[model samples]
Structure formats: C-alpha cells, structure tokens
Target: MSEALEQVAKNKDDVAANEAALEDLFCVISSYNPDFERDLITRAYAYSKSHHKGTLRKSGEDFISHPLGTARICADLMLDSVTIAAALLHDVVEDTPSTIPEVKKLFGDEVAELVDGLTKLQKVSLKSEEEEQAENLRKMIVAMARDIRVILIKLADRTHNMRTICHLDKHKQIQKAKETLEIYAPLAHRLGIYSIKWELEDLAFAALHPRKYSELQQMVSQRRTDRESYVAMAALQLEKELNNVGIQVKIEGRAKHFYSIYTKMVRKGKEFNEIYDLTAMRVLVDTVKDCYGALGIIHSIWKPMPGRFKDYIAMPKFNMYRSLHTTVIGPQGKPLEIQIRTQKMHQTAEFGIAAHWLYKEKGSSAKSKEQAADKLAWLRQMMEWQSETDDPKEFMKTLRIDLFEEEVFVFTPKGEVISLASGSTPIDFAYAVHTDVGHHCVGAKVNNRIVPLHHTLHSGDFIEVLTSKSSHGPSRDWLNFVQTSRARNKIRQWFKKERRQDSEHIGREQLQEALRRKGLASQKIVASPEFSELTRSMGFLKTEDLYVSLGTGKTSAQQVVTRITRDMDSVPDLA
Candidate 1:
C-alpha cells in the first residue's frame, strides 16, 4: 500500500477512537445512500491522502481529514459523484505537487477540470497579494466558463475550511475568515446557497472576533430553553389552527444566525434585545396555492407588521428563491418573522443548487434540469462579461461591484421582475432590460412619477424607460452613474462604434495617466514593449490603432491601466 494510504488508514482508526460518535454519524449518513459509488469516492480520497500524506493541519489532524469532511458535506448536499470526488481532491493541486494532468490520469478530465477551476494559482514574484487575489478571481471566472460545478465544489471546500479555522493561527484565521465573509459567503448567498452562506459568515465572525462570538453564543445559549418553549407553543397553536382549516403544512421555528443578528445590530444600531425577529417560523406547504393559503391563515392568527410583508412568489429573487415573508406581532406582542413557501421552495432555499440532485433521486429529472439551468444562468453571465474585457483587475473589480453588491427588484411594464444592484439607477435598469432601451433612453417613469434617468430604483418600483426614435445614444456620464458592469460595457461599446474622436481622446488621457503611474512617461511608453504587448493583447491590430481607439473613448481608462500593470513584468524597467 502507498504510504499516504497507510497514513489515512491509521488516521481513520484514530478518528474512530477519538470521534466515535461522528464516525458513526458519517457511517449512518453514508449508509442511507444506496448509490454511493464507493469506488470513485474511495479512489479520490486515497489520491488526496497520498498527495497530503505527511502534512498535519493546524488543527493537529491529518490533512486528509479536512478533504474527507468536505466530501461528506457535499454528500449531505446530495451532489453528484463527480462533485463529491472533486471535493475530495480539491486542495491537492494547490497544496501538493500533484498536477492537473496527474489528477486527470487518476480520475478523469471532468474531475481534473473541476479541480483546476478550484485551484489557486501559484504565487508569482511580480504581484502583490491583493493583485494576486484579483488575478485569482479573474482566473476562476475564466475557468467558470467551462463548468459551474467547479465553483459549487470550491464553495463547499471553502465552507468546510472556514468551519475548522479555529485550528489556525489568529492572524491566518482572521485573514481566511474575513475572505470568507467578504467573498465566499456573499458568492454563496448570490447562488442561493443559504446553508453554506450562514455557516461561512458565522465561522468567519467567530475567528475575526472570538470574544464577540463567544459573548453572542453565550447570550443566545442562555435564551435557548425559553426560546424553544416559546417556539413550541407558537408551533402548536399554528398547527392547531391550520389543522382546523384542513391545511396540511409543516411548520418549524429557528433562531437567526449569530452573524445575521450581529449585522442587524451594527447596521441598524440596534441592541440584541431590540432585534424583534430573532426567532422565526417557516411553513412549507405542498403547492403555490397552499403557500398563499398558509400565509393568510398565519396572518389571520396574528397582526402583521405593516411594510414588513413581501410576496416573493409573484416576484422571485434573482436566484429564483420564492417565499411569502411577513413579520407579525404574536401572542405576547413580540415580533416574529414567518415565512410561507411550497415544499420545493423550502428545498431550494435550504440546499440551493444541490436540491437538483434531491429531485433527481425522486425521479423528477425535468424539475432538476430546470433548477440547474436557472442556477447556472449566473455562471453563463459571468462568462459572457469576462469575454468582453481582457484586463483582469478591471474584470475582477466590475464583477465584485456587480455580482456581490446588494440587489433591488423592479418590474417592467408587463410586470416581469428585474433585479439590479441596490444603488442601480434607471439607466442601469434600462441596460439590464435591453441594450437598445438603454442606448436611446431619454427619460424614466418610476411608479408613475417622472424621475430622472439617474433615479435609484427601489424594490417593487414599476419602472418605464422612455426612449427616443432618434438614436441620441447613451450619455458618457451614464457610465459613471450606472451600477452594473453590463450597462457600462454596452455604453463603452456604443462609443467605440459611433464616436471615434471622443473615444480616442478619452483613451489617450487614460493611457497617459496609467503611464505616469508606472514611471513611464508618454515618450518612454510609446516605444515600450509593455505598451505594445498590452495593445496587442487587447486585440488592436497596430499600436497606433490601439492609441487611437483609446483616444476615441471606445474603452475605459481603468482597463488601460490594468493591462499595462499586469504585463509590467515583461516591460523594460523604466526605473
């Protein structure tokens, strides 16, 4: 047997002794799956173990345990065998000498590609860590173009890593944990992966401020018994009432996550006691009509807090999450949040993309496919956006600003729901709806009020963008006001095509500023290989053509700077 395989066997025996209950739990969960595909999973596990054989995690456990645990989590999500396999081997490429080719030979191309997508690039001497992070994000987006499952597996791997972060040093813990909060957690939330999102946020918060985490944990623990009693009483009453109406619904109550509660405290300046909706109940019904029926029944039993109700069923979230949410004053005049949704919505809310496998297991392949397509649309959009720009820093910045920012939902004239970033203006909305509408947008009417084109859209606002037949296209200033990258890119494309002189002028000014920052003045940069290579990579046939395109306002100043700096290593040192 390989040394790594022997080590893993020994580690398994140790775990069986030290964490017997957890081992039993894992076995029970694994046993429940009739189609475990044990051979594929076992081989992948052995490969990971071999790659990380002699290494011990900061937690003092064998490094292989982390990947094994991550794979188990993916299994719990009911992901495919390939996804579970990929999860098991995710860290091998980055953490060990194992290459993508080796992984492909061991597993298959699909698994290798998934691992490559999840792998972080090797450190280079040329870039700062922040620049490296931006570049890594850019590479991940490029990889995402191939298959989205890579991202899903990466998220699961990150979630598991964050969960066990307490084993690392304080500095490393805080760094990794904050990254989880700032990036991975938000990404998961965007993908509707609430289970991963909540865990990531909580663990990150714990690592960043252990004192605060502990205090909050203690405070919540003290109220646990009372909270359970109150929830039980409420559930009993709700069940009795719904049962009387012959409404078959399953109701359960849960306390808000610590990080969620902390965010409310920080953002709204509220005390822990002042957060009224700490404990909430969710009702899952069999059908859409039953969901509404359950909501009506719940509201009949308690008075709802005005303006605290939202009907997401009519206008679902961008991630396709649907539910009827209401904050109500219960029996003791205490506020409680109630969520009503169909069983399918419940599964989607809990498992997100993984719920597709759940449906497949139940022989609902059509529904599974639809859900997968809906979830994968964001991946396709990311790929599309990446194709429009070659500057990795700018691409990363635009993606972070567009995808991870807060979102607001608006409606078209036909009542089709459109979601944009929270501060997004009507111009952004116009571009999101259609590039043509945005290009010729003359004015906007938001909820029948004649508002400026720059008016920020709010949730539930019925937006109508006025367009002119005369192709008086998008204003240059609209790019500054627009929140989404899609709108910005389209506007740039329009200028690139129609206003060469203006684009060239803007591009020249941008390129000059970038050159100055890099200590290469206009005269020096004109002959520099860096400048020539940048333009070439940007698809310009000639250096002069590139300069003229920039001078004409066809592209962004930021994009010019990014490309130059990224290729700085190849440039002759002006210094």
Candidate 2:
C-alpha cells in the first residue's frame, strides 16, 4: 500500500477504536447518571479525537485513548458530565493548536475553565524544574479554590498517565513515579479517594522499586492460596452470626496495596510474615444500625485486641472515612482485622469527596457546594500559606509537609475539634486557631495542666492557649518545634515585617557607599525620580524593596550600582 493510503487507513482505525472507547465511557456515566448530557460529552470526545488524531502515546497507541481513559476514570467516580468532558479536553488547549477561547465558545465557561486549570504552563520560561512544578501547582490550586472539580479532573488525568507510564524510558518512568508517589498519591489520600490512591501508590511503587515490587507481588500471590480457605471459613462464621441477628451483610477480604505493605515493613522494621493484617475482611451492611450490630456480632465471635478498636463512625476521619475497625483473634488463633460500615459509608470511604456527586440531586447543588467547602477547607488554608510564601522551594517543602503529615485530632478549650499534623506543638495549634491568637500566645495548657511551648501534642488533647494583653509576640524558638507550614510561614512573615525598616536603612547606606566609591553623584541619584524608575525596572515594587534587598545582602551593592549605571540614560557628574 502507498504510505499516504496506509496513514489514512491508520487514522480510520484509530477513530473506530476511539468511538468504541467512547461508548464504554458513556455506559459508565449512564450507569450512575442516566440523565447525563450525552451530546456535550460526545462533542468533547469528538473534538479531542479530531485535535489529537495523528498523535500517539509512547506505547504507540493513539493519543485519543489517553483522554478516553481519563474521562472513563472520572465517569467511574460518578462525576458530572462537565467534569468528564473537561477530562477529555484537558490536554487539547495545552498540546494542540486549540485555544481556551475556542473551547469556551464551544463548551461554555465551566468546561473551558476546567480544561485551562488542568493545562500546565508549557509556554512559561521557568528557571528550574522546581519552579515550574511549584508554579503549575499554584495555578491548579487557584482553579481548585474556585471549583474543586478541577482537582478531580487533574487527579483522574494523573491516574490515567500513571497507568500507561511503563511505555516511557526507565529514567523518565522513575522520575514520573517519584513525582506521583510524592505529590499526586498523597493528594488523593487527602481527598479521600482510596480507589485512585491505592492504584497510584502501587503503580508508582512498581516503577520506582521494581525488585521490591516483584518480591511483594510474589509474596502476596503465594499467601493468597494459603489464606483462601481461612478467609472463606471466617466469612461463613460471620455470615451465620449476622444472619442470626437478622442483619444482612456482605463480607469480602481485601489485600493491602504493595506500597502500604512496603510502608508498614519499613516503619516497623519487620518482614512480611511479621505483618499481622496483610489481608483484612470488610463487612458491609445495609444501614448504620446494622453496621454497629455487625460490629457487636463480630466482637461476640472473637475477642477484640485492646488499643486496636477505632470507632471512626462516631468520630469520622477528616477525609470523610467512617467505619468501625477492630483487630480480633479469629479461627485457628491467628490475628484477623475487620472493618464494618454501612453501604453509604463504604461509598464515601472508597471514593471520598467524589462520592458527593453520586448522592447529589438537581436542586441540592447549594448543599453539595457547602459540603465541598467544608471537606476542602485544608485546600483553602494551603492557598493562604502559598500566597504568603515567596520562595518556590519553600512552597514545595511546605506543600509536601501538608500533604504527607498524618492528622492528630486535638480540641480547643471550648471542645471544638481541631486537627493538626502529628507531632505538632502548641504553637501549631495556636496558629491553627487564629494568626492573632498565635502571635499573642503567652503560654499553653494541655488537659488543664501547664505544658512547655515545645511540647508535642497527641489526639484528644484539649489545648488551652493563654494570651496576655501585654504579650510581645511569637517566640523565635517556636519555629524550631512547629510542624505546620502555617505556623512556620507566619513566624517568618512576622520577622520579615518587623525587620523591614532596619533593612531599608541599611540598604540605602550600602547603595550610597557603592556610588561614592564609583565617584558618581550619590546624593543626587538617591533623590532623583530616575532611581525609583530603576528600582521598578529591577522588578521591585518600590525603592524601599530594592533597599531592603540590598540591606539583606540578597542583592549586592555592586550589582545594583552596575545596573543603575547601565540603565540610566544620563550619568551624574564625577565627584
């Protein structure tokens, strides 16, 4: 066949495959949302296919499959039609000659905004990988603050990419896997999407640590055959007991993901055989009442281990996870783990914030919006911290801390539950309450007993931050013990604001000395409007910023004077 004819035939085949994929995606959407707008989604799919027609992924599959995969993930999450459409078109504005305005004109503002949010800053001239990453995250966060669906789409896109990542070179694969493990997986966990989170972790773990992943996979496979009969017997016993109590239940055994198993091994310094809860049995009931009833029935069957019973149903996790977890001695005298929850709670536990869409009705968008706001309060707090943080490295550092830290649920004196990072001191707690409260904090008492400022906090500790009218401000020592970015950023901002005047004074003197050494008219240049213009041209908001930069030794006196000599049209007479 002629080359042109072969190329045309390939395009035709790609289109036919993409159409089949679209049908599968639509079926997923209709399974949950029968009333979804098929026209809108079809248009988006066709548009994406048209734009990305000739392109191909590293795996040699047509590029349209990538968007189709991403959109399917979103549909599986039971996301709205607009979100699924945005997922399809996310890379169009970025990779193709298509523009945002064109998307907006065709799809409306909502879909356009979401696509734009997922688009990276490919055109910007970033100085470093860190800067580019930080800026890209900054853009996504801004869009997320406006609409949380932007992040949902981004997560779906990332999940799809991670699925096909093996097609790339080994170095590229490892790099992408590390990034997924460090950022995207944790973000999914925070958002409470365990389905995606578990997949991302396992995929990244496999890519980054192939040998360990293989060994773990082999271990899990070998153990599965041995444990099948044990799990079946346990399920039968639980089924009989639950039936006797007149509560309907579904029971299944779930294996721990490879990365989670890896984390447990490293954290406890134990081998796989030493891990008791390699597989856990989940009990799903029809109602909350049945959830507790099943828990009782399970406890009656086996003795639950102390310090292993967690009642998350009463006190749900920040990520909206609700369940009754217990570790018990099961048949044959081996330790068995069990989680009991209602079907609705299971949905929330599995899907996190995305489950909100599954339960949403037409007129309840206002309530859903309110629920999303409450669920994503941490995202807003992150935005505030990032805005105050100027350094790209600092932003990424603080972001990782926020994303990775395990939560400790503390309380205020008034009994309001306040969540902070584990190992957080009273300083972090005070800052979490309010910035002013943090600044004016004089002392702290945990559970009505006075504790030192650097004392680490734990769950259920009632924190009382005592403030005095005559208090000076936050101590510099607090930064050493503080675990939250908010506390650290606030402390740094305080010092910077307090030292600005001194820095400006020192900076002015340095510039004058430099000019005198060069035999220029120092006083005349200092007083001239030309100097202010030069400061503005140097990317400073005002003359004082340039002075402060010089005073802080961030910009040397020689560099500033040299720029001034070169930029100025007229030079002052030599002294």
The per-prediction CA RMSD against the true structure, in angstroms, equals 8.6, 4.2
Write down the TM-score of every candidate.
0.81, 0.88
Model 1 agreement with the true structure over 463-535: per-residue lDDT tens digits: 9999998967988998778888888888888876776666556667677777677676565666677677777
- Candidate 2 structure quality by residue, lDDT tens digits, 149-268: 788888888899999988999999998899899888988998899999999999999999999999999999998976777888999999999999799989998778999999999999
lDDT per prediction?
0.77, 0.88
TM-score of 2: 0.88
Global lDDT of model 1: 0.77
Question: Which residue segments of model 2 deviate by more than 4 Å?
Answer: 1-13, 120-125, 359-370, 505-575
Clashing pairs in 1: 502-552, 503-551, 503-552, 503-553, 504-551, 504-552, 504-553, 505-551, 505-552, 507-550
How accurate locally is residue 561 in candidate 1, as Cα lDDT from 0 to 100? Answer: 69
